[model samples]
Target: MRNILTLAGKDFRSLATSPMFCLIAALCSVMWSFTFLRSLILFAENTQATFNPGPSPTLQMTVFLTHISQINLLFVFIVPALTMRLLAEEKKLRTYDLLLTAPITATEIALGKFLGAFGVILILVALSFLYPLATYPIAHFSFPPLLAAYLGVILVASTYVAVGVFASSLTQSVVLSVVMGLVFNLFLWFLSQGAESATGLYMTSVLEQISIGDHFMAFIRGSIRLKSIMFLLSCTGLFVFLTQRVVESSRWR
Candidate 1:
């Protein structure tokens, strides 16, 4: 446990020192904030124009959903930047030998790295909360759905991070890892969108059942379906398992 935490801490420090992290974080923060602020202004303007007795729960829900919906796009660009170095940098610097040869197990190493990256992601996600918090006075947002929406953000962001970690494990070059990460994430995200167009009714049902986007919607709508949560967690576990296997294979060679 201590070893895992220590390794995670080391990863956190490494990311903190990297200019790439700074660039990506600054870029995402600015972009998301500006977009959120713009949306708030537009929503407010529209509400005033409508003269529909001001803010209702329905209005709040729609605005919140619309705002959270775009977060996946942010994750698509930033998650790759955040995760490309997890294992790939080890190989690039010839540190894999030292890492694999250490007393720590591959599972521990993977978990530690995931936790480290996730910690940073959580901080960024929290930073994004500023928009909602700032709007609380005006929107009078309901805590239940709002909290659930944040959970959706974390889960969806985590899905991207998991794919990025697996992609990084497959290559020594961070650029290649980032490219692969984007491809893998876009594949899953697009599939969720494409599912509805399946040829047969049964196939469509199956696709909808597995649709990442729909599951995310469930969270945004304040429905904590066990199946949807499990699907995301299973995906995370699968990638983490694959990453550990990658490390284990390289260690034995």
Candidate 2:
């Protein structure tokens, strides 16, 4: 346990000092600020207009949820960059042998790396949450729906990190890891939408069940379903397990 935490801390510190981390963090802060300002500005305009009988459409659940969804798009771009070096760079620098010969098991190494990367992602997500928090006092938004959407955002981000960590384990080239992660992200997006066009009931059902976006949409729409949560978590666990396998295999090479 101590060794795992030590390794995880090292990874977090390594990323913190890297120029790439600064660039990515700056880009994320700028984009999130712009999106939040745009959303709030729209709501302020609505409040300024003459009162309507209908509910405030400007500050509805969709508006806040859209901000979360928009962040997911940004995740698709930066997550690969964030995780591409987890194991790939270690291999490239020939430090993997040191890891392989260490007293800790491959599972520990993989889990530690995963914990570190995911921790960083959660920090970014938490910072972005301030946007929604900014509106609560003025907009009177429901907390439950907002919480559910936040869950969805975290789940989606976790899935991306899982895919990225696995990709990083597959090769020593950071470029290859990024390419693989991007392709996988795009592929999942297409599966979510493309399933609507399928003819066979069983086949379509399978595709939709596995579509990360489809499950994510349920939460975005303020629906809490156990199946969706399980699905996302299961995928995360699967990829982490696969990463462990990769590390184990690399030990012999």
| Clashes per model (N, Cα, C within 3 A) | 0, 0
Clashing pairs in 2: none
Error of 1 at 184 (Å): 0.9
Cα lDDT, model 2, residue 167: 93
Candidate 2 segments exceeding 4 Å error: 47-60
How would you encode candidate 2's per-residue C-alpha lDDT over 1-253 as one tens digit per residue? 8877988889888887788888888888898788778877876776788697877564545567668888898999888899999999999999988888889998899889888888888878887888889878876767887788889999989988988999999999999999998988878778866679988998899899999988988897778899999999998899899999999987576
Error of 2 at 53 (Å): 7.0
Cα lDDT over the full model 1: 0.81
Cα lDDT tens digits for candidate 1, 1-253: 9888998899887886688777877887788777877877777787667667654436446666767776667788888889999899989999987788889999988888887888788877887777778887876656887888788889888777778888999999999999999988877767755666788888887877766877888898888888988888888888888888988888567
Candidate 2 deviation (Cα RMSD): 1.9
TM-scores of the models, in the given order?
0.92, 0.93
